[model samples]
Target: MEDLILKHVSLEHPANQQSHETEGLSSKHLVVRRGEPFRVTLFFQGRLFNPDRDSLVFRAQLGGLLVKFPATFSKPQSYSQWNAEIEPGKSVRSQSVTVTILAPAFSPIGLYELCLHILTQPRQYSYRIGEFVLLYNPWCPADSVYLQTEDLREEYVKSDVGFLYMGTSKNVIPRPWEFGQYEEGILEICLDLLKISPQHRRNWQKDYLCRSDPVYLSRVVCAMINCEDDRGILKGNWSGVFKNGVSPSEWSGSADILKLWAESKFSPVHYGQCWVFAAVMCTVMRVLGIPCRVVTNFNSAHDTNANLVIEEYYDGMGKKLHMSKDSIWNFHVWVECWMARRDLGSGFDGWQVLDPTPQERSGGIFCCGPSPVKGIRDRHLNLIYDVPFVYAEVNADVHTVIVQNGQVLSRSVDKERVGSVICTKSVGSALPQNVTSAYKNTKAVMPSNRSTDGSPRSRRSYANREEKHTLALSMSLDKTPIAGETISFTVTVTNKENSPKILKEHINAQAKEYNSSPLETFWEVHNLLRLAPYEVKTTVHHITHSEYDEMLLGDGLMNLAVVMQDTGSYERVLVTEEFNITNPLISISMTGNDYVVKNEKREARFLFRNPFHIPMSGVLTVMGAGLLHKKVHSNVSLQPGEIMEEKISFTPKAAGTKMLHANLVFKNRPMVIRGFTTVLVRAT
Candidate 1:
């Protein structure tokens, strides 16, 4: 038995196909899901090995903790403990051995080193095979992050492409986002995110040990997604100017951002908004084996202090005042991860909110949740995590206050404006599945669950319009406004009384941002009109393209209002409507009904039409994972009503569902148009 030496080891053989490591299956590292067995074969040299007398021990090490188990030549029935064993008959006087290593469902996740010890007569030997990575397995029933629903696991864990619902609730825009968890180098970056955390820096061993718990792992991921602490991944930027880095709107996927973060030595990426941050968090959570989905709350309120109210102060001329501390966004995005809450007892084990946006600090850190959705719905404000903050975002009351010269003129409270629509992308589809009912009861019952008296607040309204009128006043757009075209809207007024009346119509338009208050008035019209007794009249107003285009910056948006004052009675009515110019679309079509296979070339054509009479010029960038290794840029110019066509060629790198995205950034204007085509890559 002097020549009983191990010759070769096999990990990439066909035996590993059942590991369910789609992304990492083709990776160089030994990638696998927890609670499942992965096989590694060993070949011996010279003479047949005698397993009856010789002994072998397999050990796996993470940080400072080491686990060792002797080879039993039999499979362990329970996945509660890590075990390694050789096949019984293969070890019987044979020169080859097949070993199975089963990691428990509760093992700490990260990179681990595996070693083997061979004990024989008069000598002992040890071999360092290689390193492997362990990720969460939703398919594993014994795992803490298990999801029995196959569709949910497919949508959350396996699906690499998804959408983030943006725009207002009335006109929700489904923005495509590439989660890219299975993309090359992305899983490693997600793993490195945990390694660079403050918890890991303080005590590496304790951090690794706690990773066995999904709750702890998710909280760390939330805090690490924002740069407010730990110099994390994204530095959020809400302001329109993104001179130093890429604007949050320009990022179509997370892999590019993750790669940039890693290539920059783990420094914070230049900028990220709510959706961008949430998308990155989803990628990390899903790649780590936690089921997650991106959610959008239209008319989402931001209560500065725990008060359940968002106040809106408007001046006498219908100008929104910036006096209040609280503000409401047109929409707010966050991620909901599915995990069992063993800490919160039973009944609270469904979807939990985990916001990575740097809005407020929780536990002196910039992370939000693992706050159970049921807790928010049932008004369980006393639970762990930041439930009060999330509850206020969706359920806060809007108190519209007309403040002029430090005096209150008129006040109205709107209960349905905040969180009128809350939803996420549906499973296996691009349509939105409304989850608002899951968050709040449809009865419109107001809960006084939040504490009061912290500070004065404010809220903005866009979804529903409230009207209180002496002589009825209403304003609405003729159609959805588009860039480089005349915007037309009609104002309707009626003398409700039985007598004739004289009125003054004050039509004002001010530039506004999506998140903050409106700026100075860009356009206004004052007209005196006479109405017959109990008569209804409608007037159409138009803002020329050049007139509104001069004030357009960052985003093509404006808050328009018409204040009607009765010259006879001194009573006034205000009607306001906020609208944005929709960007043109870049339409893409493939060559034919052909299958996109990995490592094969495909051709696509992108077409764009310039609706504006004026000439348009911009740079078109085309990119996709598994298709294009890097972004391809081409300068494009189009005349008025010109339809331009461009062709692109790409070769996929791996087999999976992928998307090819094209973005056209207009020169000297803050306008952009996007288009994408889905590619189902088959194995070549």
Candidate 2:
């Protein structure tokens, strides 16, 4: 391996501070802004170095000009190559060459053309070598942009996760997903419902799952097998199956048949949603005397952040979950299949969710029902604007959703600045090892119910253990609301454990003074369930927006204490959220080019001086009569006191001319200025 050794390097530019943000020319993706003066530095270092005694030159192609500079290798850190004498035992250790170019004065506002070329001698001879490189910087590239990651111990990798793991067995497991007797019965039932109320079948299926109704589950399976193949129970349309329209009853019956149909010139699985398709498979399997159930959950519910989603990969955390009460529940979904006892298979004896849902499923047993609770509120805030998550101080409300692979992964609120991230056990590393049987097959499928028999197989067991993590949670609220409105805050607690459990109450406080208020009144906390390990629980509190204002302004700044406690041990993680409500509206007046007077018969060049103290993005439009004569717009970014120019040409038809209005529109809002210009016209 060759170690990078620099012998000499230098910066050339109008200002030294400009050199700080230079992304080296060798970077593949170079970002740059037009009209920004920049500096360049040249560097070279190697064990073998030979200098041309005659001349060392530096060149660059900026726009059209070829700028050149004299280059020298006089300062040698590790070696002196001035003499032709060669070193036999030691190698020329280091060398460097650098040059800076001022961004051309007349560079256009768009992407400019430029390249760096280096001219130097070979190691042994004075033969000059030339190399080219690119340069550019994105606008407002910060010196330090943080990439977020979770806080986890290396041991988190070794920690075990508890899940129902069923052993895999060929005979007992049912070779095909479809053709199970139990599944067939369910599909038939669903088909019966479609016949009765096709319009509401899908909704009924969803609601049934929410209610965890075994009968509804069976009906779904039946519908999958019996309903017209082309009919989407969800959409209730007898649309074309694959390419040619077919009824659900005639839809492909077997999984293998469906696969073949998919490949066929017609009828395929593409015609329906995966869940619906899964239902079909489950139903068919039952008809053929196999057994199966659908299991679902959120992949990274309440566990990941924005950076992970933007980067499109898991950054040591789970999938990005939107911060919502049920965000954690939507992570997973799959099929749990059962056959016979010896067929139950060894390691795969437990109930396991095989197919994942498009979105995470709620953790509780509300499989197919109207979400009884409103659930947690997801909040979002634009970090660049430093805007509060909520629009109003007292009634700040925000809904944030985290999505991935076209699915909602999780949801949460911005109780504060969303501080540090706590890394939970890697989902991949959390697969449970110890297998426990929760249930054993007690009955066989009746001939009418062709579902695969799980009578031989036993269910898996789970241990209830508490795993604690320290999350430096940043909590914030929407903008403070007006006095009459109400303010609500929702808090979510995630259980990293495996078994079902409840989240206990701890300190949830909102006080004007940190010292005076007791750490409990902000919410009435309750545990909705023995939330399954890896489940999330969310609670919400609605207070009179006025009640919050007094507390917030009572001490000038509002301070809130948030805590998530484990009901068992009362172990809790505490965090504080602080915010101030202030509305400072400033008005300004401009001079110089603020007023424009144009002569109808003459062309005018106008210089518009920026008098505003802040940068802004706006458009300038020349309005006359009912028509828009000319329109000019600035980029989204602007700086204070930036000068710009505009030119307009016009011809007057009569002796008198009306005032021209120059309106500056920012963020869709307009500011107008009018000045009447007198025009004298002579008949030609």
lDDT (Cα atoms) of all candidates against the true structure: 0.82, 0.29
Instruction: Give candidate 1's whole-model lDDT.
Output: 0.82
**TM-score versus the correct structure, for each prediction:** 0.92, 0.19
Model 1 weakest lDDT span, ten residues long: 455-464
Candidate topping lDDT: 1
Q: Clashing pairs in model 1? A: 311-458
- Best-fitting candidate, measured by TM-score? 1
**lDDT string, candidate 2, 439-542, tens digits:** 11112111111124422221111111112252222232433422224645555556666665555444343443211222224433334335666766555556
TM-score of structure candidate 1: 0.92
Off by over 4 Å in 1: 443-472, 494-500, 529-534, 553-555, 567-569, 594-600, 652-656, 681-684
Q: Give a tens-digit lDDT track for model 1, residues 169-213.
A: 655667788888766788788888999999899899899999999
